[model samples]
Target: MDKKHIKALRKIVGEDNVYDDKAHMIAYSYDATRTRYEPDAVVFPRHEEDVSAILRYCNDNHIVITPRGAGSGFTGGALPANGGIVLGFEKHMNKILEIDMDNMVAVVQPGVINMDLQKAAEAVGLFYPPDPAGQDYTPLGGNVAENAGGMRASKYGITKDYVMALRAVLPNGDLIRAGKKTIKDVAGYNIAGILVASEGTLAVITEMTLKLISKPKL
Candidate 1:
């Protein structure tokens, strides 16, 4: 990685948000698997536009980018296979954007924790049923990436079933929105479906709209 490229990335997110020091690089290198592959640079983006800029820069420069969440993934999706850039979402993108009771839906950033969303929905008498074993520590984005499921999977289904829509930035720096909030949307190809379990190879997920269910009176 060129120093100029590193400086360009620092400009996108800020110096404080970019990491390249040996300590930071080593820290960002591993996931739950404990396998380490150091990235040339690690960036923590706060917004979709920031991600767009970074993706565009990397794309133009032919640099590999690994999108990472809370680092709880067992599949090593967060690992930077090639020494390029790792885009970490845990710092600034972890927010539940909306909890729409009427629609039984929640719009969230990729960094939102799975357990946090569950608690928020339960507080409002709603349920987000895709609970992985590491729900308490796993980010929703990683769940979606792995299409993870847990004890309730036989009854409730996996991550793909509940995801209604997604906002992702493609490798070419094109920002695209797929799927819709409506309960029954068959108007076009299931682009969002293709992305659900892609494991960060296709695009960088920014926001997700999850379909919730009414809390069962159990």
Candidate 2:
């Protein structure tokens, strides 16, 4: 990466959040697959705006931006193969924004852990059932990106089944909201569906609204 680009990234997210050192790059290089591809830099986006600005700058400069979660996927989806910057969300964007019992829904940032949501839902007599093998360690954003399925998938379905809506940033830095929190949304193209399992090719998901269900009797 050029010095100007690095400086610009620091300006957008802050000096501390941008790491261009070899150690940081190496640390963020591999996923569960164990394959390594060191990125030019590893960036921690504190919010949606940070992500937008970073992406806008990167896009304009023709730089690669790899959106990463917990690095728990076997698919190596989180690997910074092309080497630009790893846009990591686990830093500050990991939060369960809301849990609406009335509507049986959840609002969450991309960095939320899968099991965290499951436990939170269970606490309220609800269930968020997609339990990938790495649920205990994987982030919800990675699950959604991979459309991951678990042992319970035969009965409960996979990650895409629970997704209600998605807030994502396009390659061109445009922010878009797709799908609806309501149970039924037939108003537009199934953009959310396309994004799910796209594996970071289409856009970077910043937040997600997921549908919940009554806790299954044990």
Candidate 3:
């Protein structure tokens, strides 16, 4: 990206929001993979709209975008395979929107911590289920994109098992939502399911709508 594009991105967020320093860029270039790949810069968006705007800008400019979180991925999930932009979602998408006790569900943003949700659900006499190894810091966005699986996957199930809907930006710069808050629906082609395990390739997730359930009393 040029100075003008970077300036535009900074305008979308703020100069402090964008990181292009050699050191910061170097640090973000490699993930847990130990493999080296550097993107021109990294942007930490503080809101859903910011994420969508960043993706739209990158996509429009033909710049690559890799949606990342926590950086705890074991398989280079955060590594920019081909340099472009690493859109870090940890700053934004971090709110737990609602807790519907009547329906036994909770709405959360993608950047919400997995363990935080699990604890909150338990506090409300409910359970969030999808417990990955990195429960402490793994962002729900990465979990959804990775369609993360875990020990409970064989029984309770994986992240996608509990995801009911999401708000993501496709490569074409459109902000879209898939799935629903309803208990059941067979509406369209299940774009929701497809986006579940896409690993940020198909698009970038700005927010997510997950299905929650009440904790069974022992």
Clashing pairs in 2: none
- Please report how far candidate 1 places residue 160 from its true position, in Å: 0.5
Reference-based lDDT, each prediction: 0.92, 0.92, 0.81
Worst 10 residues of 2 by lDDT: 68-77
Candidate 2 lDDT over residue span 78-158, tens digit each: 999999999888889999999999999999999999999999999999999999999898889999999999999999999
Which lDDT tens digits does candidate 3 get at residues 1-218?
57787788899989888887788778788766677788878888888778778877876788888778877787787888788778876666688888788877778877889999888888988888888888888989888988887777786888878888788887877888888888787888888899987888887887777777768685
Runs in model 2 lying further than 4 Å from the true structure: none
TM-score of each: 0.97, 0.97, 0.93
> Clash pairs of candidate 1?
none
Worst 10 residues of 1 by lDDT: 68-77
Candidate 1, residue 115: how far the Cα is off, in Å: 0.6
**Which sections of candidate 1 miss by over 4 Å?**
none
Pairs of colliding residues, candidate 3? none
lDDT of 1 by residue, 16-112 (tens): 9988889989888998889999999989998999999999989999999999877777788889989999998889999999999998999999999
The C-alpha RMSD of each candidate to the native structure, in angstroms, is: 0.9, 0.9, 1.5
